[model samples]
Target: MDFRTQTSSLDALSGVNADALVLVLAGDTLPVGLDASVAAAAKDAIKLGDFELKAGKTLVLPRVAGLKAPRLVLACAGKASLKSARSAVQSALSALKSGGTVHAALAFAGFDSLSEALVEQTVLAALEVSYVYRHTKPSAPAAPKLAKLSLLLGKDDAKAAKAGLARGQAIGAGIELAREAANRPPNYATPTFLAEQVKALGKSHGLKVEVLDQKAVEKLGMGSFLAVAKGSTEPLRFIVARYEGAAKTVAPVVLVGKGITFDSGGISLKPGAGMDEMKFDMGGAASVLGTLRAVAELKPKLNLVAIIAACENMPAGNAVKPGDVVTSMSGQTIEILNTDAEGRLILCDALSYAERFKPAVVVDVATLTGACVIALGGVRSGMYASDDELAGALLAAGDAALDPCWRMPLDDEYEEGLKSNFADVANVAGREGGSITAAKFLQRFASKYRWAHLDIAGTAWKSGGAKGGTGRPVGLLTHFLLSQVR
Candidate 1:
């Protein structure tokens, strides 16, 4: 959608030509800046108990006397805060979905002034509510008609609001790209398919894209990654994409993603129920591509490299079985105690491969463990970092982007759970603290540099009515990368 900033004044509102006007109120009393007739209409509605000043409440007026817009929507934010503003925008947009409105002007009342945080959150919420998945489902309803959005702000806040709109648009596009790839079925979004998507993104953004086939991966001694690909008939692809906005000598921020496109638990098959959701196993890989797209669009003055170990984990005759020991690119041995724990196996080699970039920091994203879902639920992604500084930066970034993550303990004691009887380490530990053990397994290969892991199994997608990819952590990752820009 096209977004721009407009002056939120009485004269400006008089000339504003949109199908609908959204007035975000911070309290019960109307602010002094709204158009006289529009404010009177809203005040009358509140007095008659037609609308309450509760958070996320909405009231629609078919026509306001003096406004150029045909419809007026009064949305309650309850208080002046970024979170409330976002919810108010979302609530207003949700109410307009079935209408014929094509453009909406959003003006905040009773707030101090429009800030970058407010505008950015507003745009992000609009884009998120506008998303509709219709790629595979031909009979799905068409998306909403609302196509253009205007954020009404004062003249002093125009510059900052414009910047926020740009960032929001870039990040929103990235989220859409991630959700599209993740929502596709396994047959349509295979390892090769993902490599093709990366190449396309690279060509458009002037990035250096490389896809390592099975032979090249084997040449690099990625036995651990190859083991996960053995069961699938489709070929495996290791993707490396580079965005160089700075000097080549600069140490780049490396992002490694686990790309198990369709995980069937390999020789250890998962239960039949809800197996279709396994297509979302590549959510980490999707988010990596999404963040790269956003960073490339913004042209941050920092070098970035993305590494994806794309493959499928299936239960076939030649699939890697439990009790098998595999050697990784780092020369570390891992015992396959449970093939379902394959995300870490592929990521170990990918993290080891990231060392060649001489990275300043490496953060690997993966839908790693179900135990993480039980621990943190869907509210936060499970984060495990080697140092406090890196963890704090990520936590702050998540907070700034409204995509939150909680740091989990990584004490040396957790390593004991991953002890192996024969190999250097076991891929799977006991059921207790399964997520921490999974992070500890990946930590073994990231010893060469500062590293962190995001276990996104619980936050990547939803299961019930909203059974689709949420495109999570893309915002968090984009914010984190932008924070590193110099």
Candidate 2:
């Protein structure tokens, strides 16, 4: 859909006519003067007692003689929240479906410090409907799509609003990319498919793409990552995409994603029930790629590197058994106690490889543990940062993006769970502090850089009814990158 910015006067909206004009007011009342035509139409609706403006109240009314539009949508939802605002926007979009063009006006002055949030969330909410995932079973019936979106100003200037709209659009596009990758079936989105997707993304955005084969990965001694790939017939790929907008001297931020394309727990197989959802085991990898997609579009003056260890973890004779010990690129040996806990194994080597860049920071996103799903649930991703300052920065970015994250402790005591008798560390680290210990395992190889771990097990996707990748942490990760460059 086309999105544009315009000033908040009747003259500005006079030349253009929309199917529906969505006017958002503050609290339970209309503002003193919301565009002359809009105000007159709303006043008529109020007089008829058909629509009383109040908190969370929404109404669709016929446009009066003075208004240029055929219909008017009054959303009395306050600018207090992204969720509520999105609901209001969905209503406006639904109202405008009968017509081609849609116009939206929100009271920016109504929000105090949340002006930017209100603008960004509203735009994001409108764009959220743009991603229509289709299936063989009729394609969710196809919602009527709008041709253009005109954002109207209420009681604030146009500059900041325009900036927020651009930011939201870029982030939204990135989320769309992530969701598509995560939603695809395992057969269609294998390690090879992921490598191809990264190359396509790089070609479109001027990024340098490199795909390392199993032989190449073995040469680098990524034994831990290769253990999982050995069982799958589909070829393994260690994909790296670099965005070098900054100078060579600057240390780039490195993001590592666990891209186990379809994890079947290898030798320690998972339950047969709900195995189809394992397609999203690569959600972490998808998120990093998604974030890069946005970064490419936004073009920040910061160097970024995405390391994706793409492969499938299947149970076969060649699969690493529970007793197997593998040497990582860092020369650390890990005892594979439970093959289900494979994300950390791949990420450990990737983290060790990140040191070559002398990175400013290294963050790994993974669907690491079910323990994290129990701790944080579906709302937030579990975060474990090496330093408090880095954690604080990520938290702020997550908050701004509305993709919230909760920080978990990275105490030295958790390392005890990962102690191995035959190797340097054990992959599972027991069931007690599973999530924390998993982070501790990855931390062993990332001591050279300011590192952070995001366990996106719960937030990456949904189960049951919604059953698709939520396109999470892409928002959080993208916002964090933008914050650093800004």
Candidate 3:
């Protein structure tokens, strides 16, 4: 474990021995106390303008004559907001590619305005940059190892800081899990394979895990979820992992994930171009499992249940046709107007299943629409919620975690396009309000409780050279759960 927490005074910090001592310089704000002294010591460098500490800037200084550490990283924290401060530190950590051990005093001068949440965000962002995702290459490439990352905290806020550090590490581990799963190829990451992995993970983590088979799904009348699975040789898999950290009576927060391990659009085959990227279809399920992984370590005083509807959408003789209609577990008949629009079919069933728990809230994550990627680009997730307070809480959580979401219209007007001549609702609402229509479809099944939908298509994974799962929303989900506990 390279992550550790320590508290040191501004005066004592100068004498401590470590690789790099990170300091933050807020926008146009003069350094004070230890910060001022550190600057004064490096006055020549500051005066000569050897380094700049503008917002989101990073400058590395080595061989300081008087400083105990050989390196000093000055990160610019504009306005000292959590987002800006986190990015500043993130840039510095990324620059230290050959990481050994670094002593970070990121909250050094912002003590009065700095809270534990801010410290936590900084630590997690640092850890995030340091993470190296690998795959089944011929051999593991040698990479820089971050042996240790110690956070320098204020004496008064030491306790909260320690808590934040722990939270950061746990969430980081969870995110790594999500990224790993999403990065795997479709052939290697089948529906049954994912369920088996989740079952094994629960055993290791001491969580209550149950994998429901196709028979179980048939018994529940989940035709909509199963229709998508019929094309692939892989069996349908649904995972329900429960973490009861609070009292038995407490209603748990339910998270439903779309797990179409590989989507070939079934009989509605998509164009061959970029089809390999379908491996990332299960990003939503990976995130749910990732959040549970963190919760297992954090052990907060809140009960939670994570549900994944796992399957594959492939073109085959048995594949469901575009004109077919299937009934969901909720007895709602859905017209399969387009085979490519399958994420919502799986999520709707899981949402209906969540009603069994009488959850306090329900949120389903899915890479449901290409429209989301077009709308939000690669920056933020698209969110839709009927309840204003739930939507607002999620927005606040995203802000705190740096995994932001923009609320799109969940207006009833969009549902009209889903009108089907043959069924209760069409699986898709043409291409107009695609993302919002997808969210609206899932909303019908989750009306039993306060609910939110996260359309993570844009934010889940990057394309091109950095192509891989981003492990989004895990940080957002973890932060939101912790808030509920408080």
The CA lDDT of each predicted structure is 0.91, 0.82, 0.83
Predicted candidate 2 versus true structure: per-residue lDDT over 86-192, tens digit per residue = 66777656666655544444333233433556667777777776556774236475655565667766445466777778788888888888898999888899999
Task: Report the C-alpha lDDT of model 1 over 456-479, residue by residue, as the tens digit.
Answer: 999999999989999888999999
Ranking by lDDT: 1, 3, 2
As a whole number from 0 to 100, the lDDT of residue 305 in candidate 1 is 97
**Candidates 1 and 2: which is better by TM-score?**
1
Q: How much does each candidate deviate from the true structure in C-alpha RMSD?
A: 1.2, 2.7, 2.2
Worst 10 residues of 1 by lDDT: 7-16
| TM-scores, each model vs. reference | 0.98, 0.92, 0.94
Model 3: worst 10 consecutive residues (lDDT sum): 102-111
Per-residue lDDT tens digits of candidate 3, residues 1-486? Answer: 366667676666567567887776676654555644466654555577765556766677776666787777777777767777777778777767665544443435653554767767876777677667666765655555545667776667767777777887888889889998998888888887788778877899888999999999999999999998989898889899999899988999998998999999888898899999999999999999899999999999999999999999999998989999999999999999899999999888899999999999998999889999999998889999878988888899898888999998887888898889999999988778789888888888888899999999998998999888999989999988888884
Give the winner by TM-score.
Answer: 1
Off by over 4 Å in 2: 10-16, 35-56, 63-65, 79-83, 94-109, 112-116, 135-140, 154-156
Clashes of 3: 0
